[model samples]
Target: MRYRSSDEDSARWDGFPFREGDIIISTRSKSGTTWMQMICALLVFRSPDLPASLSELSPWVDWLIVPRDEVLARLEAQPHRRFIKTHTPLDGIPLDPRATYVVVARHPLDMAVSLFHHVDNLNRERMAELLGGPAPAAPSAPPRSIHDSLVTWINREVAPAEAMDSLPGVMWHLTDAWQRRHEPNVVLIHYADLVDDLNGEMRSLAAKLGIDVPEEQWPLLVDAAGFAQMRARAAQLAPDPVGILKDRNAFFHRGGSGAGRELLTDEEFTQYEKRAAQLAPNDLLAWLHR
Candidate 1:
């Protein structure tokens, strides 16, 4: 399926060259996309100090702001094992056996909370300029409170492919990946697991990706992938190559989870669980929310 938004078009994957051992970090916004990219970079390079910025090292291919030809050329010029990033789901992009698809799943509420801040952190005027459109006007009305926004986001109904960040959209992206979890080239990593055990997760992912890191360098690579560390280096790590983020450091706001669930009443939480059940299978929801 072709997935296109105002800012991205999955159809751009057409005629793209896929090299052996290419890694595609397919994830929804604020769902640990950059984190996985960092992990892949660390594993691929066997060092914490990358050759370039994270955004340059791993470009978002589907993003419309970057010219398709330029992005392709950049990827082509890279001599290292390419690890591309994308918000499009597994079903939306072509599945190449030679490439590994790493999909990160986060708790819906936590993802929603992070996304709320992410949208607020965006520089709309800069984005509009990058896309060759006129700058967007400042908001006339006050923005919705995070609590109110979370409630609305949970209840709003939309097709999964159409709104990949909505409740349904989150489920859609994960559901497709969950089904393909057993495939050799598809790997599923949970946000909570990474938070709970960064060291172990990084080691496990390295093993899965067939990367053999020397024992002496494990500590440095793992530390570099930590939330605090990433936030500290936000200028280099945050994915804002074109000055799209208002505050690059703000992009790493609240690396932990539960903020979204805290904003809801008991009834509201129950309602969210029920809505999630309707959208995704029982086992998938269990793993996702766990």
Candidate 2:
């Protein structure tokens, strides 16, 4: 996503303005944002009978394409318990005492790769068509694969951070939330753990949310929100003109863990590791390694 200056005219957010006891779903993109949204829905609603599609249930709060005020208005309009989504780091949010924030982390390697594919689907032409707004100019006719776009964005996004010997803003994002993981009102979940142990993570999530559904219902909730199942449902269930889908049914992409490393080069890997070690805390990097 392009980072427009915070001065851009619009509600961009007058501060998170969180209502008391509302749940806020926040994370960097592709770091299990949708997955955590689903988990929170299950916990809050306490049933598999999800009333609306994912968008209605949990709306994006900081989508630059939309006016920030419009995003907040949509979230505020929701009658159900609010669970708004954001990719901004915690420093970007309202951080009010009334909200419960859940931050989900994916291995940077996997996150980078997943983000690459995600950008590919929003190619300039596709973005204009899907977003109904001006699309970025296309690159000079090279056959740009998703990986290329992902890497380019990372490079462009990282230059400032690299110049400053920082891990780039995205790494700072994960570290900030990781540092706050122990707060009673904040929950930190590992995407790999969710992939490896869905049931256990769901239970842990429920416990954090102060929910306690019957034990037998756990499997049913997990199955209902399974990647394949959710993707299948989303084809029809998602709002019209679904944003950034390569195909209607392929939105979930691959849900496996550690995919980012497989696509990374030795050099990129070395740089990634060096930057991560320098910018992110040792314990956080160690957690991702685990």
Candidate 3:
């Protein structure tokens, strides 16, 4: 399945060279893509002091703004274990047995809320200029409130590959990974778990990636992965290699959960649950909504 969007193209991964022990952070937008990249960086380097910016360390492989050849060259030049980032689903890209695929799942409602803010932060004019496309026209009406936008997002129907940020699209990405969860190279990590227990999650991720950190450095590494810590260093940590964001610090917007849930009525919430059930299996839904 090839995913083609204005900003990305999954076809770019067709000839990607995957080395042994390569880590691919497969996730949807606003679903811990940067967070997992940070975790992998911390674990791979075994230190909070990364050699380069987080975006430079783990480039988004499928993004159209960055030349595919350039992204490949950067990865090839890296000496350390490579951890690449992608918003494409599992089926969209080639699966190499030697490489580990880490899928990060966040609550759909929370993800939707984060995405709402994310869209606002993006500099569409800059993005258009980078992609060599016409500048987007100004909106005729006022932008929808988070509550209204999310309600529409939940009810909107879109083909998974066509709109990876929609409700169906989110489920499509996760369901594909959930089925492969038993595979040795596939690992599933929840955003809520990371938020609830950053240290434990970081340790578990390090163990899974076969990177051993010295006992003395555990506190430093885990603290570096914290939301507040990442926000404080937003200039380097936010995924803004180019000037696509109005404010890099805004990219690290409230990393907490339950904001989406708070905006809905009980009936609306139940409707969302029902819609999710239709799109994903019971076990996957349980894990996602939990």
Candidate 4:
């Protein structure tokens, strides 16, 4: 497959050194990327208090702001099983046969709602300092209300799934992963499933990643990944020590589905459904939106 890089430097997956048994956590943004990262950290370290922050332990390789060589060196030095994070879909990546790829998803409406707040948290000035350039212009202020935010988010269309950050782009990201979910190397996870049964899901993920935790240690790993514990450790789990977020706690806001459901009108909900149908098959749509 032809690989492409995003302006944000997310496409730097090319030429990445992949060792056997490496785990690649690929998911659309706000679709439980940090959740899965924490899970991997817990499973690998088998402790609630990691030696380093989650982001430091499992860095997003394609994030250009961090410096590609620095990220590579950190991963290479790590002796534990490496699990990397990426926002790109399968097609945009190298698709190594020797490594395991775990793709996570969430209900689209809920994801949008979470992302709306996520955008608000971003500190463009800090990001620009990291990039060593003039800070990008600040984003327009958020809508006066969440209802207005959802309406604007759903109606946005910069390109037809051209950028992975757009509404259409998010659909295409899920569509690519859904298509290859049956492959031996690719495993699919849902945010709703985690919220429903985190312990069960963590065990299942352990099996998928070929990690065998001692039965006694299971509780520690599961407990550490729970919402409350993670939220308490937000400074460590949050990737924005650079002050990208206005509030660290807001990053973990309402980690369940249905926030968007309550905010949408019947007609707006129908429009979202129609758009989903256009982007994916019925089974995938049902699985995603559920």
Candidate 5:
């Protein structure tokens, strides 16, 4: 499966080195990838202030922007428990029983809305500058407003797992994880669950990743993973050291869900539901939007 969006090549995972107890945080784009990174950072470092920038610490294994060898060298030197990130679905990458996989999911509607802001804010020219390559041509005009953007995104549908950031793509990622949710090594988490109970989710994740923070330092770790804290440290947390966005904070935009739900009209929402039904299992969809 070729995930064309953002030019990410999932093939890079072919030769990934997975040590025992390695943690893989697999998620659809904008579905709390950075949030999970922060949680893992606190858990691994056992400190409120991270040793290095979160992005530098947890590089997307499949992202093509950085050379594969460079990414490998950085991870190879890390002494702490390695926590790798991938936007690809479970089937897209190697599945090692010795490694624990954490798949984070968000409401498809909300994810699309978040992705809209994310794609629109991308500074590709800056990215090219950093890569020492000619800037790509400008993108076509985008939808003028959030409402229009939602309408456009919700109506677009690709095959399940076809693109890690599309409507069906989100469902496929969730479905794959849902199927293996009961497995000891694969844990599924919802964005809503994390938002509703940050500390609770963090503890659950810590247990899954076999990370134990001293009882006295639990609060510090929890507080550091909070949305506001991550936003406050956006520059350090955001992966774009090359000024990939016009505003770094924009990458950490609204953390809430249902933005697309509110923007979608009755008829359009009906279409969305129909499409979602065709893609995801009934129970999985129930847990997702709830």
Candidate 6:
């Protein structure tokens, strides 16, 4: 399906509907969207009964797959917990005081690497089949290179998804939210912490929502949702999972940290840091550096 960009100003998000008890995981693409989804699912149901891909259970509300009205209507009609996925920044979303919003933070460098892997395995033929027929020309013109695509979208001009080479755009997206992390309802968790301390973060995530996961069950939940475990379980879970890209193996692609310093060049790091200094809050930048 071709995704149409909303000509409507993100400012009009006030008109977008949100409901009480909704748990919205809003973040830039590939920035731990699935990780937080899994965390939240465990918190809400206390059992990993919601399939492998959380997106199967809770779809991306803003994706072109479903119209906004249908999304709003679905939220309003649903009786069970509604945990929606979104790649839009916070301001673009209608704020619901009653909803629990989690915005996971990943180092821009790591996100870029993850996205690079994302493109490698996309298997356009498979995606074309998934989308039905030939792939649509990227909404914007085809990007000359990945970096060019990043330039196009930051400007919101037009660029092919392939051209969206995000050498530093990933940094821009992260820094933007790092600046906004102070918002009262937005909870920020670092990919590093989430990866390094999965058990701790899982427990912490549960506590943040006032959910008590019995200590013994933590092992069961953690084992079931671990990266390799989840990847192995993907086909069985079926449909789609949040964070798991269009392809199942894509989700488990190189989940690593400290990539910014290791993989990015001094030139690239400079570009990333400069953008952060200009747009990211000083405090958030400090957190990233740490």
Candidate 4's residue-wise lDDT over 1-290, tens digit each?
43233324545777988999899998888999999999999998887879888888888876767788888999999998898988877887888988999999988888888887897787767777777788676459744687887777677775634567667877888888889989999999999999999999999989988889999999888988998988998999987635667788889987888998899989999888877787778888888876
Model 5 agreement with the true structure over 67-104: per-residue lDDT tens digits = 88988889999998888888888888888988989999
Indicate the residue-level lDDT of 15 in model 4: 92
Model 3 over residues 203-271: C-alpha lDDT tens digits? Answer: 888888899899999999999999999999999999999999999999999998898999999999998
Ranking by TM-score: 3, 1, 5, 4, 2, 6
After best superposition, candidate 5 residue 2: deviation in angstroms? 5.3
Looking at candidate 4, the ten consecutive residues that score lowest on lDDT are 1-10
Which lDDT tens digits does candidate 2 get at residues 1-290?
22333212213545657777687777766778888888788777777678877776776755555556666777777777777776666666667777888888888767767766665555355546544666667568976775665455445545422222123666777777888888888888888898888888998877777777887777788887678877777654332234555565555778888676676688876766776677678898899768
Candidate 1: where are CA atoms >4 Å away? none
lDDT of 2 at 10: 17
Looking at candidate 3, the ten consecutive residues that score lowest on lDDT are: 203-212
Give the per-residue lDDT of model 1 (tens digit) for 206-264: 88889999999999999999999999999999999999999999999988988888999
Query: TM-score of model 6 relative to the true fold?
Result: 0.75
The TM-score obtained by model 5 is: 0.93
Provide the overall lDDT of each model, using Cα atoms, as 2-decimal numbers.
Answer: 0.94, 0.68, 0.94, 0.83, 0.84, 0.62
**Candidate 4 clash pair list:** 123-244
TM-score pick, better of 2 and 5: 5
For model 6, residues 1-290, the per-residue Cα lDDT tens digits are: 12224211233234656666778886666678876777677767778766434655566766643455665675676676777777666655666788777878777656765666666555455445544557545546543555543333233322222222243434444555566667766677888887788888888767766677878788888876677766676564422432324666555776668654675457766766776566456777788767
Off by over 4 Å in 2: 1-11, 67-70, 123-135, 144-167, 236-246, 265-268
List candidate 5 stretches off by more than 4 Å. Answer: 1-6, 128-134, 138-142, 160-162
Per-prediction TM-score: 0.98, 0.83, 0.99, 0.93, 0.93, 0.75
Question: Candidate 3 at residue 70, lDDT?
Answer: 96
Error of 1 at 101 (Å): 0.4
